[model samples]
Target chain A: MVDRHLFGLGLRKPHYGAFLDGAEPVPVDFVEVISENFMVEGGRPLDVLRRVRARHPVALHGVSMSIGSADGIDVDYLRRLRALVDAVEPLFVSDHLSWSRIGGFNAHDLLPLPYTGDALAVVCANIDRAQEALGRTMLVENPSSYIHLPGEMPEWEFLDMICRRTGCALLLDVNNIIVSASNHGFDATAYLAGIPAARVRQIHLAGHSQGRALLIDTHDRPVPPSVWSLYAAALERFGPVATMIERDDDIPPLAELLDELALARDIASDRERRAA
Target chain B: MTLRALQHGFRDWLTSESGPLAGRYPAGLAVYLNTYRAQLMACLSDSYPMLVAWLGEAAFAAAAATHIDGSPPHGWTLDAYALDFPVTLDGLYPEDPEVAELARLECGLGLAFVGPDAAAVDPSRLGNVDWEAAALHLAPTFRLLPATTNAAAIWSALAAGERPPPAERLPQAASIAIWRQGFTPLFRTLEAEEGEALALIRAGHGFGALCAALVERLGEEHGPARAGAFLGRWLGDGLIVDVN
Candidate 1:
């Protein structure tokens, strides 16, 4: 985990110039990037990442780990990710607790997983292989799902078991909690209460769009009021975890995102003062 | 359902026109299907902007939909999904050969962008080498894309945001050489003689053979001179990684 409560933003393409060539450093404590984008042999992407790493701490977040695959974790993917981790020496490495591949066919989207004991065993085995291969513990984030597969336990219970069995931590995505809770008719606050609070090492704050039947984790807009409230509650529980905001589409100016990071800092500060 | 059975069910629903997983996931089957298709489409559209421009937006969308339905992604990286699209274009627009050729060029450039890096052979180091027995090793990113039409010109025009010329076939076939120079991926249309020599080198031929072949075709006097010129150009282009 990071040294302390850190606020950061996703280092996207449009803001690469600003982050790399600015007169002053971007004010965030760290920057997160999609790991798959930089998992290349060598190119401009690696060059840019090296330059950026010189300025700020980076977190490697991936989308294709498919930790819940029934067949098994992709050993080749783990090897490449381990190489990237060795190069970046990131503050944290994380991927969603969802499967995108099964039987060699990768759908390339975060597909949902049932919370049954059998699925849990598969996930734990995969995480064990990943952590062993990477030589570092991973942070698995809960995903927002539109379909609620019938399972033996709630999502929080499943995550608690994963943390216990695989010795991995949590990258709690508050936005996902809201989206999934609303879609599956679970209590969002209850989820925050149910998770292993000490296991949360980082937190993701993002925006979502309401689809016809469910909330989609779009990450396009600013962190809405609802998500902010949950983030505050998460800080109260998780206690100053590393926080970052994600905006993948229709990106605005970097200053706007910094302002959002400032809000997160304020929330953590408020929680600390209340504790005092 | 068992975990394996459930996954196969989801795959079938996502990859085919089949109904929603035997009514097990009716709530968000449409969402998963939409997300799956949209992600693949966006990947293709992003990877082949030049092709998307050459083929209008609607036609490209239709082609992307067709490709996505028939081809499920198997690689961990979504970038690999775009590599096979040129073949799909070949099947879709066999009459317009430029379409497939343009897609191939785009895919080659993309691959070269992230391919293994190697330093070009230093000219100073080449001075004492035995010219006859030395084997020419090209950069790992080097790719030879066959061309029978003016696809390279179309790609260049579209990349420059200029109006592309009408698709036309070349009177003679040629090849395009793609490789990275420093950090930039580059491509050049190779002359027929140069293409054959490069192909020979790529296939592990020694410098003596290239020289002998050029000498055989262009005769000894101009052949050696032409071989020297090719060496000079390859070294300058950062294509020759090693001459051992």
Candidate 2:
């Protein structure tokens, strides 16, 4: 979500050597890293991240922010993340639209939140606290949920309300929409249509698996045709957002991911052609 | 339900099976349970890879399950989940002392790998210091752990992808020193006297008192020489960060 069309990949361990070599660039406009992985006191992890930042623009994506915690936000977490943000000066800083911590116990997974007015207030307040502490706006990604708690609004309405209330942005995950739509029996297109397109600054494309009775967001494989199709739809709506292919497990070589990013470029090119 | 009550319901479902959330959302609850346990187990496996290799997968998995059942994660980060695993290993293998010792060594090395960064004092700068009054400040990452078995040797072998030796106790008391050097985590065994000396320094004892203790143990002739030798080793190892 810089001012131009952009494509990238989630930096993982398997491709560290390729990305850090610095002889030839990894063909990414920017590389997104899990902020917590590099948020250490000091060591090779931070050293490698600094080296990579020197090569390409970076994005700080987090998993444990727990923005919708009913109890409150963790100020300690915000302080550490702020330090990393200042160091990297990344293009975008993001976490999921979910809560993981409550009453001193951290679930460590993105737990679902009801889209009721109360939950909306909690998320907005937490996001406000985070943005103020970070001294910059943050993007909150839509999470793929398995269970739907009793709520008054849909997930898109909730996201729109959050951006309006906190002056934040959005990192729309295409695969999460596909998975959640299929799991909860909602319309994916309708879900996309409801989001505020102007506020979406980034897009996450990944793969999922079929659970016994629901779809799970297991980012362990290549992006599927369904996800690609949804990505095309999302691009059409959100217009050339910063898109990336995220493969967390069973990570292929750097070459394979680049080929995937190339496909994203092709898709975006195709969209622009139609617009013309 | 109120958001607080709803979260507590989710917590009960994850920590224990007896909760209203489970009955209402059986299929979804199953998915979460599996993911929670699997992620915690994977964390233990990652943090203690050597221990997993030493204990083999099945035994390590069982021990991890017990720990997860009793210790719900409290820290915001998953790395803290590995902190209490060594204690769990102790309870599970009371007679097999090597198992827990190996876990302790691995965990300590992991901590030092990301501990605070400090620049070791240059050896050439030692001549200007007033030795009697100087308090030798060790590296912030420096950690001394008790050792009753040959866990350090076992760790080395496993890291090199070689077959580890049978677990055995040492003839005398010992400890292991873990710290980082130039972005690499390093460890070495410490003799009983050296371990006591380092512990004293860590507890804020000055170099003069350390020499006096050494002199009291070994006669006046060798005591000062031994103290000087210890200082040289510590300096050479990049363990002493400052002297004041």
Candidate 3:
């Protein structure tokens, strides 16, 4: 049965001033930030974050941690991220189980990591170092994949092993699961079943674009019905996780996002009611 | 392949045509290359809007492709990626000073918009201080730029949704002053005298030296007055943060 669940929306720059204006009431539990956006020394972004934090809980979701890079995490990047963490006091901080930078050059995409044993060990070590440096455990989100490498293990096993080894929590993005499952020919339900229920701390729901060969995890559209179904399965497995809708590009109005978030809330609430 | 090799292969494939996507994952490879290109190009466009206006979308994208090839982003944040793009554009169009100047103006705006917030300079406390002993501190967001073309006007017009004036080069060397005033970032051309004085101040020149320099430029009678006028302007512009 679902116990306690929270709904949130990913905060983007376009809606910053609106969120601060306080004219309309938003119906989400907290706002998740891209983390790097507010990693400035002092500016309007930080000021807005401070004002927003005063109003709602914040979750620092980062894109550039590169936690799976074999070259290791950038020390200065970690210190700056930690500084932002100290300042924001987010409910929790998280990044993908993918790497962005390699060999001193950063591609800035949530680039895939081969799900090999060595890659798993590297990411787990990096996560451990990151948590130690930040003085707190961080949740690692499962990223949408485009291709499966030759010799890598299953994505779910990679996630399970990383969380188990590093003591990190799972973000368990359901949309990513559906997107990857469609792209790589796997069952989204089986992917969820492989994950340990107690380890999930949050759930990310978003939309994907249908490509000719694969589904692209572009968080531009509303959550599709198929992803919503997978999210229900996730809720059944990892009950009552903190859930948020993530939209990065072609952002709709705050009201539109709130409506999508309400659907997630309704789905979860119904699941809970049925259990009751 | 090892994770390191796979990632290295990923980066190589992204920046080049015939890199490591040779035997595997061609479908996914195109998606990532498209993403990296789109992301970095959007950042450059944001930082250099006037360049886009001058060079249309297709031409701008082509030129930006060269810049992107020359300098991949090395920072954690894309905010700072366009910092060196003006130079890259300068090299791309050495004969067209307007390109680099417009990129510089746009980049300056981005910097001023995100730079540290500071308390506005207090003008009333100027009376009790000794002029020569006080070294003025410039605001954290304040920047001085030497302009070669009417790029500032182009940027201003683009900002105000008006048609650009003309792309003319200046006969005399002029500098543009950019800083964040309240929440708005602004830039304006500086008179030679004001620019010189700001240069001296930026170089840690004291008030006495500034006054003497103004005296040498103007007559003795109007020199200190002009210096005080500059002081008033700096304070009013929120350009100075401290006096030491």
Evaluate residue A206 in candidate 1 and report its C-alpha lDDT on the 0 to 100 scale.
95
**Local accuracy of candidate 1 as per-residue lDDT tens digits, B83-201:** 99998999999999999999999999999999988988898898889999999999999999899999999999999999999999988999999999889899999878899999999
Q: What is the full ranking by lDDT, best candidate first?
A: 1, 2, 3
Which tens-of-lDDT digit does each residue in A19-137 have in candidate 1? 99999889988999999999999988999899999999999999999998998988778889999999999999999999989888999999999999999999999999999999999
Highest DockQ against the true fold, candidate: 2
RMSD of 1: 1.2
Deviation (Å) of B16 in candidate 2: 0.8
Q: Write the per-residue lDDT of candidate 2 for residues A1-276, one digit (tens) a residue.
A: 456679999989888898999589888899999999988899888988999999999999999999989988887899999999999999999999998888778889999999999899899999999999999999999999889888999999999999999999999999999999998999999999999999999999999998778999999888999999988988898897899998998888889888999999999999999999
Summarize candidate 3's per-residue lDDT along A1-276 as a digit string, tens digits: 125899998888778877777776466788899898888867677888898888889999999999988889989889999999998888889999888887778888899877888898899889999999899989999999887776567888888888788888889888899988888898888888899788898999999998878899999899999989988888887788889999998999988998898898999999999889
Residue pairs with colliding backbones in model 3 are B132-B208
Q: lDDT for every model?
A: 0.93, 0.92, 0.86
Name the better of 1 and 2 by DockQ: 2
Superposed model 2: Cα runs more than 4 Å off: none
Report the alpha-carbon TM-score of model 1 versus the true structure. Answer: 0.98
Better of 1 and 3 by TM-score: 1
